[model samples]
Target chain A: MIVSLTHLDTPAALIDVPRMQRNIQRMQQRMDNLGVRLRPHIKTSKCLPTVRAQIDAGAQGVTVSTLKEAEHCFAAGIRDIFYAVAMAPGKLPQALALLREGCQLSILTDSLAGAQAIVDFGQQHDTNFDVWVEIDCDGHRSGLKEDDKALVQIARLLTRGGSSLCGVMTHAGSSYELDNQPALQALAEQERRVCVSAAQRIREAGLVCPQVSIGSTPTALSAQNLDGVTEVRAGVYVFFDLVMHNVGVCRRDELALSVLTTIIGHQPDKGWIITDAGWMAMSRDRGTQRQHRDYGYGQVCTEHGDWLEDLRFGAANQEHGIITLQNPASLDIVVRFPVGSRLRILPNHACATGAQFPHYHACEATGEVHIWSRLHGW
Target chain B: MIVSLTHLDTPAALIDVPRMQRNIQRMQQRMDNLGVRLRPHIKTSKCLPTVRAQIDAGAQGVTVSTLKEAEHCFAAGIRDIFYAVAMAPGKLPQALALLREGCQLSILTDSLAGAQAIVDFGQQHDTNFDVWVEIDCDGHRSGLKEDDKALVQIARLLTRGGSSLCGVMTHAGSSYELDNQPALQALAEQERRVCVSAAQRIREAGLVCPQVSIGSTPTALSAQNLDGVTEVRAGVYVFFDLVMHNVGVCRRDELALSVLTTIIGHQPDKGWIITDAGWMAMSRDRGTQRQHRDYGYGQVCTEHGDWLEDLRFGAANQEHGIITLQNPASLDIVVRFPVGSRLRILPNHACATGAQFPHYHACEATGEVHIWSRLHGW
Candidate 1:
């Protein structure tokens, strides 16, 4: 039984700080070479230190999924904030509060009613709000199609209703389902084209369309060229997970976020080593289930972070993780892992996993651990 | 748009207080009639107020999965807390800290090493620890099988190693898979039998085994008689979810936990009404996927808590939920839901979904909303 790091409670979220730094640098350098500014989405790591690291590495601004992220980031001195999800009308007062507090907040809309709500809110507040028209590149989730007439219509409403029609943005979120480089590159190009097309149409309609933003972690890394895209936004690259690894974007070793857990017991007859981390610690994200490799809940590794390739982390309860042999030939599971042994579990989705904890234990390569607080809810 | 609750943020965790009270009442009443102590597992809510409600309604003590939960509940004057997850040896100091602080903390161990560690720790501290031997009722997760020789061995280890062998406990978590009443009842009886048999074996070995505990929400609710069980422990009954609903344990209307979200945008042609509660808010728990009914992400309900049976919440990104018609197409999706309208999303697993937020907006049937903080992480 290893006594070192026993102080750390099992089922703790750990951030490999050096690996995270490498990931940030790699993404920033790629975006720099592509001639587009990187606005690292703060959704992946809601912790400010990671966002600050990205900002210091030349990330232009930050893209947030919730108002809580904007509030947390803004309070931490990040001025340029983009609320990436389409604006909800009821949230206008909150947005106005942020704007009044001098947050350069940009909101999104893809529908005529959505745009109208923003416009009406802006008029009601007697202030102009920065707005982006979301474009649909791959029909993944939200946004208007690239050729949708509502793009220009929404732009016109924003401009006429006293809100600034800042630009067009699209997230090729469907790129996550792709595993090949060619498919990723094609989707990246389409993502770029969609946003640029929407922006061009808006500008052609005599509205101010200054910025064109497009990305998803896969598209951002795979795009061969960024013809008209002004800024690239991507989350999850900072702490690439098993899902991203399966998508052929990041190497499995580059995964920075992992749940530090301890082997609590074992079902020796069943070749199962039970750990304290389960769906509660690793999260319920089955992001890699349909990929080339399906990491049931997460991938297991040794205390020093070496891959445990033969052991499969599978079938989790709330707090009990059942790790068993992939080949299942009856090794002494109890004697091998024993109790009190610690292991690092690479999550399927970093964002979901990180949210499971209130803070991350950032461990440096030199073995120093720092606790970084994370913003949780909206 | 209803402006009454517009002050509340979107994608918020909401607890319908009245419904929650009913759930607590239903479980407590059942346990009361079953002639066993109801040690409510606080893992579902992880909030003090809800646990206090359960206690106020006749629960004996609380069952916690993490030491953090134990610490929090203990601080709240909940003296008897069973740290139900098998004791991670490394967490012994933390658990010891709780025990030293006058908290009646009961820890569990299913393996020899686990029992040895607890015994060693107690011996080193010159104190006797309260220990529960976990029995594997069903072949789902952790614990030793009822017939396993380790049952008596571990019990003897604990009793001799300066620790009080409190009893044997088991959770028929596999009961979550059953959809019919007969299967649930069978699993419940099996769960009780396993715990009782293990305790009987330990007692036959002349060990001090005083209690027999067994449960899972489905089994706890379905058990015809508790025969030899001294106590029943179950969580997720406080806020029943779609998963429990699929298991035929709880009704759809009995679920107390729901995410309060706003319609943010739409893809009218695709018949998708987008909302702010995506996986980030509703959680990544697709617990209902393999069940009788698959609520894609969650079941959509009105702000007043009425179910929208036609709308299925499908395909979620980080911050956007796509709620669409079950029959596919034909609805004026945007007009029906609108951009500012509020809706409640019933989760697949209440425990998973409730953990997504730091606090729940506990809305009384009288329309008053109170924030109840939840304990997150280790």
Candidate 2:
């Protein structure tokens, strides 16, 4: 059944279908031009319909952060899956199960112990697991440094353990901090060079490392060349948020995801219009706090999707959002935003905000909404 | 079935049932002493078992932030409930349905327009909603200030529209900012005074306002006198978190909710033990950031629930947490927290963290885990 924006339940996760499709097309076209497979990270949406849209727009396999997502995507008929996080030792059995069920599920490892566990599990199960060595292009988070000797050590251990050393992957996650084109492009280049070098070093050590995967939403969109990279994995670009907007990757108008809420009450004297979309709906991801712009909780928009330049959702509790006006000089908030009026709030981090809801109200061009169920939990 | 913490799934939400019961007993005892009914806000834990525990421990009814919560709780045989958020015009039908289904559900309204909507909906549906006027005790979020003329106007409108003017309710949400007893006690007094005054004003205007409700976790625990207040509602006190720890309400040992995570990898040079419990499991609630102590993402504890004083979850990504050693002088993170080792992380906000999971692994004194399903979304 088709539902309009007005009919949607308050505090609903609304995916502007046209904007989402445009975002998908933009990222897919960029990857196509760079001659690299675009393994769109389904972690951002976790909704099958959203993943299907990405695949329809020329995306290759899906990149997942959790085993649950891999299983969900596999159940939705997408066989090629990559569990991107460093594989936990106990989670090996789950990964093996996915592979046994005809899923091209690739697991990641950055340490010898991780690789050895995979090796042990592979040998015990008589299954050669497809494993990728995670390389750290930037010292942002977890991964074996590209120049570290452990890269080849892990690769060798995987092969010795009867597991297939598929490739080396890296995420220049710090690219999210860069707001300029040059900085983003440089990080993208560095991410490409380092990850490719890791793949080369692994191959030089008598290991077959075929794929060199690298990306982050910012790096994927900014890279001028992929060079030796086989595939790019990026999330959040599929539903551009305030963080991506401040990172100079996408315009605010390009953001596809928003929380549809109703103005429940008002503190007229404080010039605050309270809404039902609190941190629970918008998420506590203050991703834009240190960015070029700090959208406290989110940027408020009209029910029609027009930006409310003067209004910003500054503070949020469990179930109440305190939306205050920037210029409160002459504004009578209670008169301007009467109770029961609906509003759309664009979140700071699309990934975090999208995770708050169980499903997305996919809004089409004709104002119709389709409920897209999301995969939750591990 | 009995399960040790180490044997349970990694990145799971675990509720320390014993500690929760103690927390419940403490709050219920205090409310009993104050001569007021305890309507525990089930928003903190939308799990039926958790709410059942509260009800079992002398809680009269439940306070819900969303209609979905009210519906979920009502289905579990909890008939009396307070839909705390100001009524949205569209949700009147849902409330009416719950009311028709024999739920003694109470709705809140803070504005003349909001009250009018309830009145209009009540008249249109031929249902009289037990409406409560929300008074703003502190300049925190939503509510009409206690002295505001709109309070009486809203109540009058509710009475004239064939709705029962139940009472006035206020939450001293700003009490969260107070860490000292003096400030908390004073704020608690303020919350009680303002809410009672609003109730009196409504009565002086020839309307029946029997219920005078007020609270917040801090205020509910600190209030010395109830005076004219009929009931107190508070959430988060059930499973105290790091925020409550810093609020001087609960000791670190008293925290009942902790994310059970497994150390997946290590950044030895950076003194970081990477864990599977990311912000996705612990949530991005930095509620303690502005408190007396900033516990980064969360405070680390041993698998047995003992505080790991030297460790703290400093940062988190989608599926990875960077647990750093506070004293890295002689600490070998890789050796101390070996890969695959399990740990428990007490959350900054129990309400936020618990919402991330589909169910809580309720851990009893014997280390047995019982899956308690959680209600998600509106």
Q: Give stretches of model 2 more than 4 Å off.
A: B1-4
Q: Against the true structure, candidate 1 has what lDDT?
A: 0.88
Per residue, candidate 1 scores C-alpha lDDT tens digits across A223-342 of: 999999899899999999988998899996688998999888877767888888888888888888899899888989998788889989877888889898865565666667879888
**How far does residue A360 in candidate 2 sit from its true spot (Å)?**
0.4
**Judged by DockQ cut-offs, is candidate 2 incorrect, acceptable, medium or high?**
high
lDDT of 1 by residue, B61-128 (tens): 89998888998988889899998988888888898899889999999998888899998889999878
Q: Report the lDDT tens digits of candidate 2 across residue range B1-378.
A: 356655576789999899999999999999999999999999999999999999999999999999999999888899999999999998888999999999999999888888888888888889999989888898887788877888888888989889998899999989889899999999999999999988888899998998998989999999899999999999999999988889998887689998989888887887888999999998899999998899989989998788888887888998899988877668676778888788889999999999999988998887678888898888
Q: CA lDDT of B311 in candidate 2?
A: 87
What is the iRMSD in Å for candidate 1? Answer: 1.0
Q: Which candidate should be chosen as best, given DockQ against the real structure? A: 1
Share of real contacts kept by model 1?
A: 0.97
Candidates' RMSD to native: 2.3, 1.3
